[model samples]
Target: MVSIDEVARAAGVSTATVSRALSGRGQVSAGTRSRVLDTAAALGYVVSAPASSLASGRARNIGVLLPVVDRWYFSTVLAGIASGLQSAGYDITLYALTEDPTERAVVFETFLRRRRVDGVIAIAMSLDTAEADRLAALGMPVVALGAEHRQLPSLAVDDIAVAKLATAHLTDLGHRELAHIGILHDVDDGTEREHIPSLRRRGFEQALDAAGIPRTSARHEHGDFTIEGGHAAAMRLLTGDAPPTAIFAASDEMAFGALIAARDLGLSVPGELSVVGVDGHELSGFFGLTTVDQFPHDQGLRAAREVLAALDEPAPPTTPETGPAGLDPLPFDLVVRTSTRPPRRES
Candidate 1:
């Protein structure tokens, strides 16, 4: 009996394409589909299943694991993933994961082992050794975003550097008194290196220290990465004695909240208060807030494409797990707007 891989190689396409072409369940150009048909007939290849199920050697679907569904950044990334997968004639099976040990194990051991998906894409949800072992055992492609996994490929932004850039912007503008708004420990991959909020905070402090400023002289507050949380944090910072001249929010939502807090306090932006944030949120320009644009949606698309491209390649033999290569860095940039400027002279 000939294998699906043989037919795919002879047809000059991926097994997924062969499955799609044979099952007529996914997008395939008429010419390519015809060619696949001719090649299969010539090779005496026969379809084991009609609807491209696991028996067909391709599921025409991918599993997407996410840490959160409600947040803007996550939602945006999910949309991009969905868009990329759909355009490629594939569907997605969504899984929302948590810290629950049993639940996590069920996903990796049971649900995924069922093999309904051709591959897996995990966004902002890190997998540990056991979990990575289980996934690796599945013999399918896996891609991670935001959260990095040592055993598998990952794409993530340099959070520490992103934060450093945001903070450095404020410092470069001659703003000495700085405040940072973001709660620590939002998400921790097994490495602890990808812990989002904590990394940003470390970046903030690093930037301050580099500027010959005492770390203790700067203010730190928990913003929960939300508008309300940011507003409350900023309110406390702005209302207190000797408030900061600049605020660097870990996220754009929090930065918007800071902007609101400044307005409510009757502080003139770029004069009495300057605020910057990470994440190039849609409203960043509308609010005139400077930010680091990490391109979350593009990040999602890239992750999706990584898994898809992997599908078209032959499976590599199992090898020893590579040690601590570190997470792959995604691109980011500092987007300056009207929200920041050198503080006006008191004289």
Candidate 2:
């Protein structure tokens, strides 16, 4: 690797000048900075991360916290984040957290304190008062995605409204007997309020109530936001007595499963049962499923931009609502497709 000393000599400037020009930290004449940059590029003199950190007191790294890595939504968001952060010349340290209390304690109290990261981006994780306190104590910019957090700035969709829009679509299509997959029963994913399924369930129930359909009358089955889970849950719903005319699944994956179950039971989609789901999964169009498109990749990009702005980095600035107490509502839309239509009139 070429050293900074060689580049400084070639550029006819001091190493301090080269450092300032590359780091963008101190004042240097434009002509000198340009020359130093050209020379550094020519010599392939990349600054050492440790040396730069020691000098600037910055890690130039962001830590990402995730609950599950195997899921489609989480993976897509992570891809967007990685692209944005890497483009900004920053490295990322991924932190995979589990449900174990001891492990979480170590992360917030011990691992984070090691100063390995300059800031944190938490994706869809519920934080208790204690966890929130520990994060605040870190004195680093923290941004969360797909969550409603009081202590941290978040980029989240109004899930309740999103669900209402989806449910209303079915009701407007003249479907009354509707089944909801992915909500209803008591589930413990740390905090129900912060959990996506619980919030969506609230919206689903609210929409049913507004349609003059008693929440009690509506059919429901629980799916764990996976295709397999959706398949099993949907199979049960379809096999039961007086099966619903339409089903509103909380996720596109579940909706896919519902479609499969409908096929297995020899039911024609839209002719007998229509289905709708959440998340603008890539496979949604292929499956011809009407869904609410939440744009998970865009969410990730916005999240990374928010974190960079918080760190006062030279990234594209977001709106004023990115303050510590702000809750920036992300965008979502309902996409109509072949899987959803008015139920056929009963003969």
Q: Estimate every model's Cα lDDT from 0 to 1.
A: 0.86, 0.86
lDDT of 1 by residue, 1-347 (tens): 77788988998999989878877768999998999989988988866543346445777789988877899999999888998998876889988888898988888878998878989988887667667767666788888788666666778898999999999999989989999999855554454344788889999999998898899999998888899999999999999989999999999999999999999989999889999999999899999999999999999899888888888873455554563334458999999899999988798
Worst 10 residues of 2 by lDDT: 314-323
Top lDDT prediction, candidate number? 2
Measured on C-alpha atoms, candidate 1 has an lDDT of: 0.86
Off by over 4 Å in 2: 29-32, 186-194, 313-323
Per-model TM-score, in order, reads 0.83, 0.93
What C-alpha RMSD separates each model from the true structure? 6.4, 3.5
Pairs that collide in candidate 1 are none
| Whole-model lDDT, model 2 | 0.86
